[model samples]
Target: MDTGRRAGEPLVRHTVSPHLTRLLIDAGTAAGLDRGQVMRLPGFDTLSVDPVRIPTATIMRTWEAVGGALMEVGGVARVMELWRPGTLGVWDYLFTAAGTLTDALRASGLHFAVIADPVDAIAVTRDGAGVTVSWDGPYRDHPSYPLIAEFVPSMFQTVASSGAGRPLTPVQVRLPHRAPLSHAALCELYGTRNVEFEAGAPSITFTEADAATPLPQSDPALAAILNDHARITVETARPVVSWLDRFHLALETAVGDGPPELARVAHRLAMGPRTLQRRLNEAGTSWREELERLRQRRVDQYLRETSLSVESIAARVGYSDPRALRRAIHRWYGHSPRTVRQNPD
Candidate 1:
């Protein structure tokens, strides 16, 4: 009960992740609108679209637009069904983070899956003495063990602090695996001294008083809305065919006014050129090759299908001189541009 003095201070606010932007686009698609159309919808065109997060207000406005459009079929519940856990962006630090716990509980039940497994979810429970949050799911050797192990206790600390209005350290912390690297740093980061390394199931335990304390910042209404949105976002999600196709789409979007370079295309995709190159490498391709391929197709089209002079066509495809274009054309085909045009293949 002694949560260090001041009682009426404000809590931190967290922004929604941009993944919800993808969700809004999905909602538009469900209502038979293309992404461009949705982006063009008032209050959205000016917003900078990121692949990770977007403004919560923009999400609300987008929801109004998409939700309104879909009202004819079945209203908000129809929209809610399409929401997924990934779609629910972190609302705020402890406030929103706690809601995520509730949302995960709603989606996964008592047990939370550290990774993915619809049938055998993770368990989060409480008993006569204290509360226990557990993730004893089947993925013991899951790649996310380190991440989830760190995240669970950190989150409990957050929920406790927010609920008690002070830094309420956990009474006990347990890890499913060995303590992560940089052990000294972990203690400093978690600021907790009662950690049990390799406790098998990775759980957090808080005193009965701290666990029962009210999170005044908690808003059940907002949590319900977010949970619904998260569910719906997952249901109607569309998968990107491949990184190459995604790059092509991003490139095409970048070249709206004229020819676009690799940097410009990378910027449009919300990544730096180096990061883009690495991702492309993982996809077994290179940016230079993709750009060259796109240019080749455009150049061939200009030569065969359009009446633009060869010099003008050269400029359009990024060549400075007609001679350079001619040399490249010869490299592409054994004959001159005129011969290729005449042959029409």
Candidate 2:
């Protein structure tokens, strides 16, 4: 049998287990919206045939719709409230079956690609006495990114705390987005109030001792079986490139030495400058827009997370003129660089 995927197939950049999509839809229903209303929201029309995977882009669009629908009802808090552990299918099971939080996190990290794509964007590292997990990617531009940003760490807390049989607070938490309207919900979820906004990326850190604590539900026999299944799943569904993610990767590399030039990015992507521009246009964005957004995020991070001078930050982000950077800061944030740095809230 020819088991290879068909030719001329499009690459799905990212995907989630169908259960995650169902969770999003269910959140909308729990918020008093009819099921039809959620399904009618953009990107729910395509049904998943694989039973395990659903396009994450579809979920992203649906998230925006659900957030808008729930804006008046309860917002992201309601979604988090409705979310329950063990609803994530195999991904969740891998956690409970593991011997300790550290083992579970490592296993989850290894099999994450089975549930989502662009697997390299996530990093799991261990310091002397702490383990840190972080996700840094082009996903910040998506409207639903902030919602997912907050939701993910909270979910991690819930799962880890429950599995460990004790509350394990993160040593630190960092988010790239601004703080939400209600900190109460977040404080309650993480079991800690030490959350920093406008960070370079989304990350959570826990002490190594906490991570090594054994879980009561650990079942090595079942874990071995699930590990085999996860390995098979990841091997079967290889990571596929998304053009948007590729562009982001190229842009990030290009911006290291200096400003990101369209020609340089195009060459990096093995496409002509014109073709890249056309692709961006078709995606409802342009090179200038993405460049500006990237610069804004970098500038914001530098201002909030560093003690760098405005001139230094401007040069770092490719602005030759410090005054120009100041004007951009005012335009984007309605404040001066100094003000933004001091009062990120």
Candidate 3:
């Protein structure tokens, strides 16, 4: 809902997502912000605020400060209570009609289009043997992107676990360039291997095998049930997870060549190292863990899916010494790089 701030008013009057309003409440308390002051701000209605009326920039700022606080407080689940039941039925129809993950993404993009806060764009591409689904648009500040990114994975996971389903493993993301701090929050949330910066696109990638897997129709009754409640869970997780996805993409793009030092990452994120650490901690992860996770995942993917040698793969993923890289790989997967390459596991 629009807060109706006039020209020259402080940015506080910007429209805000209901999810973000909750996050601000949590963050303000954690930051020692006075609750009375927050509630006094224009458009401070805790309930019934229009999602579209909230400005994207305001949401971004709130997310940076709050990180995953809303999800931690169950704000997302609570927000889901507002969605119309028909929303889920519509999503189910799209899920069934789509033939692949790529297809599902495209359909989702279209479905969001009728709404005022639709996804910017969804693009499908082939990287090596995998398919990438890139989503970009004004969602930079909206809670939907993060929520969608997080929930989509679960949706894929659910479909996969259901037997003969196409489960998605999130890969890289490309986010807008301006807000590095916002990107940091995103990286921690999605746990993706890479986060590209200021790229021409913002999207997620899926393996070809995963993308090609058909939707399971074996349990029509069960599918319908799951569909009915899909929006409920999606509403809760969208903001936090989507922000993380964008952050991961930014990190991947920045450090794609080598492991970025804390200072460098902090610089990219426009915050001091200490501040970055504090914010990351609030998000329930550390920079070191995120760096290592990206490295290990990239290393494994290269070894298993590509013909790149250990030395070459090491360099591509930012490792300088093949031996050192081997140690890292062993530590992560409990097997040597050569072993992995030979067996292609």
lDDT for each candidate structure: 0.51, 0.69, 0.49
Residue 255, model 2, lDDT? 64
Top candidate when judged by TM-score against the true structure: 2
lDDT of 1: 0.51
lDDT tens digits, residue span 1-345, model 2: 001221112333455555567777888777766788668743455434334445565565566546645555645666656656666656677778899887887777666654555332556778884877776555554445676777666666666776777778898888887776666656766667888888867778888888877788999999999878866654455333367757865775576556668999999899999999999999999999988977886677667655678887777777778998999999999998889988966
**Per-residue lDDT of candidate 1, residues 39-84 (tens digit):** 7743354345432222333443354345434434433333434554
Candidate 3 lDDT over residue span 125-221, tens digit each: 6767566555545433232344434333333333232333433455665554434344444554445647666665455566677667776644456
Worst 10 residues of 1 by lDDT: 3-12
**lDDT of candidate 2 at residue 154, scale 0 to 100:** 64
**What's the CA error at residue 84 for candidate 3, in Å?**
15
Candidates in order: C-alpha RMSD to true structure? 20.6, 8.2, 16.3
Cα error, residue 156 of model 1, in Å, equals: 4.5
TM-score of 3: 0.36
* Candidates ranked, most accurate by lDDT first: 2, 1, 3
